[model samples]
Target: MAHAAPRSGRLTPGKRDRKPDTDGSPRVSTDVFSERTHLVVRWVLPVLAGLVVGYWAAANRRSGGPVTGWNLLFGFTTALAFMVLCVAVRVAASRMKRELHALTWAVFLGGTFGFVYAQTDKTALRSAVMAAAVGAVVFAVLFYRYYTHEDAEGHRVP
Candidate 1:
């Protein structure tokens, strides 16, 4: 058999040509900003969301009343509480097993939703019942996802 000339000016196949760095320093990834961007998105997006939720809750509580210092205080307090809970849940869930992680999120989602719903002048018993129902639904959905995505040892499958 006769050999043919290598294509694309490469003597060897499957080898990539790399350019030397102009500054003589080690090459850095082009995606260096991705990690920082992810960090900002992970925290900042949630904080923004918490703030929106807090505003909604405060508005609901105000019930068309004029904005007052107390109302602003309540909104800020609620926003702080929501942001704290979001961070806590994220950290705790990451460290927990699949079941516990799902449960943690379910509880958080249900409780937050219920609390916000309750601000709409709903009765305490109604809010509790709604929370329970929401919790159950969230638990079922999260448990299903976790079960499908994790193995028997609770390790995630790629």
Candidate 2:
């Protein structure tokens, strides 16, 4: 019997490699963990952040005092409120124009900061002014980022 020739790396007229073409474009993620990661980021991270903020508020309010039922209640309540408002703001901002979206987050940040600051015995006027300044700065920064990173149709630029 005659022996056949060994296969080589060269491409033949009737055969093509199964590997996909790589044209330097981004590839879609096929990993199963990606969806789980997205879910955790979209929900769990925000909840954890809210809890941290709540703890900070409670600690600031306590001011070296021992932990009490009232403190726990206040902290959990603040956490719940913060989470709800965060979700609401995210949903609302997603549907708004770019300007409104930036403004929404700015307002949320400023209001949350002001609330936390007020726990430190600061004057209401002082907290308000600080919050306004913070909001202005946040708005300017976010607006510029969104304006540059998104196209006219609001889609993100690659």
Q: Pick the TM-score winner.
A: 2
Task: Please report, in order, the local distance difference test score of every candidate based on alpha carbons.
Answer: 0.81, 0.81
Local lDDT at 74 for model 1? 85
Encode model 2's per-residue lDDT on 60-79: one tens digit a residue: 89988999999989988988
RMSD over all Cα atoms, model 1? 10.4
Worst 10 residues of 1 by lDDT: 8-17
Error of 1 at 62 (Å): 0.6
lDDT by residue for model 1 (1-158), tens: 89985333333323332543565543333332455676898899779978998898899899999999998888888889999999989988977778898899989988988898898889989998998899989999998998998876677653
Give me the runs in candidate 2 sitting further than 4 Å from their true place.
1-33
Candidate 2 Cα RMSD after full superposition onto the native fold (Å): 11.4
User: lDDT, candidate 2, residue 31?
Assistant: 37
lDDT of 2: 0.81
